[model samples]
Target: MKLSKGLLADLRLQPELQVPDAALLALPEKVLQFGTGVLLRGLPDFFIDKANKQGLFNGRVVVIKSTSKGDTGGFEKQDNLYTQCIRGIDGGRKVSEDIINASISRVLTATTQWEEVLSCATSKDMQLVISNTTEVGIAYVEESIHNNPPASYPGKLLAFLYRRYQHFNGSEESGMVIVPAELIVDNGTLLKATILQLAAYNQLPTDFITWLEQHNYFCNSLVDSIIPGAANIDTGYEDELLIMTEVYRLWAIETDSPRVKEVLSFAGADAGVVLAPDINVFRELKLRLLNGAHTLSCGLAHLAGIDTVKAAMANDSMAAYIEGVMLHEIVTAITDKHIRHDAAVRFAVAVLDRFRNPYIEHKWVSICANYTSKLKARVVPALLQYQQHTDHVPALMALGFAAHLLFMKSPAADDPFAAYYADLWTQHPAETVAEKSLSDSNVWGTNLNTAVPGLTKTVTNMLLALQREGVNAYLERVAAEIIIS
Candidate 1:
């Protein structure tokens, strides 16, 4: 049987599945979503669906497929019904749930149904706007909102808000809570700034700008979940929009507005939705531990011929290396006066468990995308901070750094960083490559060798050792040294 709204009655009889209440179908469209990607569907929509099922937030989503790549036939065929298979370890226990998410009421392509999408702006029920248009999608572009469907995400959003402003006569009560789930820092702030900039470029009225500034609430939000889509899983029924996500989920929204809190009543229904004045701790924990660990270990794991994160975790030496890097180095550096030490340790342990999730096939190569930039942003800071605190080199970090350089020896032609390094190695000798790279201020923001004493020597030695003894043997030696030290 296919997963569709028509099959909901029969699906309800199944013991393994959780079907949505028939009453939820009539819920008013309250959320204006800007993406049809699985992350948004699996995380935000998942929470909204859970809230609606419990009759807390009786709201449905009107999704705008901002891009013109895929058709909305799947959504139409299924009546906007999709299966969410939650499979992962949570609090050291296995969790598995099959939920038929009915959050999205309809999917409209922005290019074809611009007027219909604009019509959503006038609805009193539409009090929330959410977007997940990727990292680049939140950029600033000087585009006029007068186009049939504005060129950029911010431009489209400006047009929508302008229509709303016109419809409500700049009423304060008609303002919407905008939350962007893009994986960028201050996503909401940047998005709001871009919208205002676009408004200025389009020569919008001063009263409309004042209404936008005083009435609307833009919340910076951070989302954490591994939604790898449903292409690999079988759920006993065909579903075009099936999504698989980890049981662990977090949607940290930064806002103190009473109205924002009131409108987001769904937070009361789920622990996953956290409303806070600041989400920096959550952001730092995630960026440094989970994402940073992945950045540091990915090169070494890939060079060791490990295919997936789970596969690397299965190896004792590789797993130990990852743990040591996070707990001993990254966690230690991140746990300062602002962050609690115990909390950072717990988060690092959880990250290790997530990495060992057997169901998730997170490939090392995928983590190695834009390896140089990731090293600078995620790994280098920890290295520098650890050095500052301890006045000693982080051996594991050095090993990871060496492995990254080794990995970049023959990088893809398109990767400018890798290509630059390749050219550097071609011109300079192996012994000098570490010093050259470590001193490249353009790459690391500052000369790494000058910042961390003996860093260049450590990396050079590790690079030579890796080339000679292989990653496994080198990791074993590092592990033995850590034990002795």
Candidate 2:
């Protein structure tokens, strides 16, 4: 048997599986979602379905498939039903749950069903707009919304807003609480700007533009969860759309308006959904702690023959490096007033638990894309901050940096920094690699050698050590020292 609306009847008998109530399926469509991907399903849709079960947010979602690529047949065959297998460690405990999500009422292809997509604008219940169209989807593209469907996501979205303005005669209550889950820094702000740019480019009416600015609330949000493709666990019935996610979920939306809070009532269902007047604190914490640690540790972990994050955590040396760099190095370096050290400590402990999730196969290589740039963005600032406050060199971070330099020797020729690093390696001997690369101001913005006085020596020593002792042996020695300290 395949998982669908019909499967719910029998699934109710299985106490372990969380099956939705029949009444939840008949709720009115209140949210217009813009993506048909797993991250959207495992996070936002999961939250909505969970909320519906608790009667907090009694509404369904109408998804817009903006792109014509890929088959939408899976959704149609399963009646928009899927399973969310939340498996991972949560605050020093193991957690595993299977939930059937029935939040999506239907999936409409925007390219083919633009009229139907725009028609939802007339519904009073449609007060929320959610999207996860990746970072590129929110870009400005000059096009007309009248060509059956607009060529770009911003264009299509503008057409829908215009339709809503026309239907409600530009009423304030008809506005939407727009929250985008793209990984960019200011997703919602950038999206709204792109829409307004498109509106002006298309010569949209002045009143419509004013209504767009005043009525709609574009909320900048940051989402933290690892949806690693399909779930590995088996349900009694096959589910084509099943997704596996970690237990640590965070969807921090920036908003202060009472109306926005009320409209996003589903946030009440889970502690993971945090709504605040300013979410920069959350962003800084995530960037410096979670992402910063990942950037610094990924290359080292990968070079040490550890394939996944779980494997690295299982190894004592790799585990020590992870914890040391995060709690000891990265946490202290973050000087944001909004972030307390205890809070940073707590977040780091939870992050360790997440990293130790055996079910998640988060490969180190996958995190290695844009390796040099990631270091510059996530780690370089922290490194600079740490150097200013302390004279002692950050040993673990230097080792990680050394690992990155060594790993870059094998990059494809087309990578932006590949030729630069290749030339450095080709001209200088292994001993001078650190000094040569660290002194270059073009790639890393500042000359790392003079800026962080002792970094070059520390990094150079570790880079040479890695070449001589290999990562495995060197890691054991480093771990022994960390444990002793």
- The C-alpha TM-scores of every prediction are 0.95, 0.97
User: Every model's Cα RMSD, please?
Assistant: 1.9, 1.5
lDDT of 2 by residue, 147-216 (tens): 6888787877888899999999999899989999988888999999899888898898999999999989
Give a tens-digit lDDT track for model 1, residues 24-88.
98999999999999999999999999999888899999999998886999999999999998888
Clashes of each: 0, 0
Model 1 CA RMSD to the hidden true structure, in angstroms: 1.9
- lDDT (Cα, 0-100) at 230 in candidate 1: 75
Error of 2 at 450 (Å): 1.2
The best candidate by lDDT is 1
Overall local distance difference test of candidate 2: 0.89
- Which candidate gets the maximum TM-score versus the true structure? 2
Model 2 stretches astray by more than 4 angstroms:
411-415
In model 1, which regions exceed 4 Å deviation? 411-414, 481-485
